[model samples]
Target: MSAPTYIYKLVSFSSPVPDPLPEKLPLSELDVASGFIHMSTPLQVPRTLKRFFAEDPRIYILRVKYSTVEKNIKWEDSKGEVPGEVGAEGMFAHIYNRGLGTTEIESVAIWERNRDWDEPLKKAESWLVY
Candidate 1:
């Protein structure tokens, strides 16, 4: 049987680079803007991502949100975790299992299946590209 597929949503913010800035400027000091929401599946997960979660032994449900400042991006999480701090770009909820190792994550639903949010996640890749 084929293994189940898993999908994750990632969001980021971006803005044009600004003019010269003072030394020791923090990210908060720059302009930021909402980028976009992207959907990713296990098949598409990068090697870096796999290495990052190698020892975690838990699957995750990630939700991401962002806003723009002058030209920098500010991130937040609906799950109460600090946004943009987890390395990857998004908010996440960890789903764990006691003895089954890790819970299998199937496909994720953002807009096509569910429309809970105003913005829906775009597919990781377009079929036309293939």
Candidate 2:
């Protein structure tokens, strides 16, 4: 299948996301320590939640227009922190050189992490801008 036109971001914070999100999102702890913002494709979001956010009650999902942030994104291998870890074996998008901006986001949604995290992502195509 062709690559998606958008990339997705799952954040584990409780504050309501500001409209038009801040030009430079306060980088997550990992993102700050690593010096890059971590992002995934639509199909990768659910697994990401299950692997890294299972304990969180809810997470925010950001649908980012790929072309808008293409210059800053790098596709790199993520072989988990160790091995045999779920959701950490593919090439993921990492934003470097600058912080993510609203100009690149198409929309933002919240997912209540539960037994059904993967349901909405099954309709990933519908999340495309057009």
Best by TM-score: 2
TM-score of each: 0.20, 0.77
Tell me, by lDDT, which candidate is best. 2
For all candidates in order, the CA lDDT equals 0.27, 0.69
The segments of candidate 2 whose C-alpha lies over 4 angstroms from its true place after superposition are 79-89, 119-125, 128-130
**Tens digit of lDDT per residue, candidate 1, span 18-60?**
2232222222111122222222333334332344333332333
Q: How far is 37's C-alpha from truth in model 2 (Å)?
A: 0.7
Tens digits of per-residue lDDT, candidate 2, 1-130, equal: 3445888878885645677688757777788787778888766766787888777777788888877877876676553232222223476877777776676767888767556656545545576332
Q: For residue 128, what is the lDDT in candidate 2?
A: 33
What is the alpha-carbon lDDT for the whole of candidate 2?
0.69
Q: Candidate 2 at 18: error in angstroms?
A: 2.6
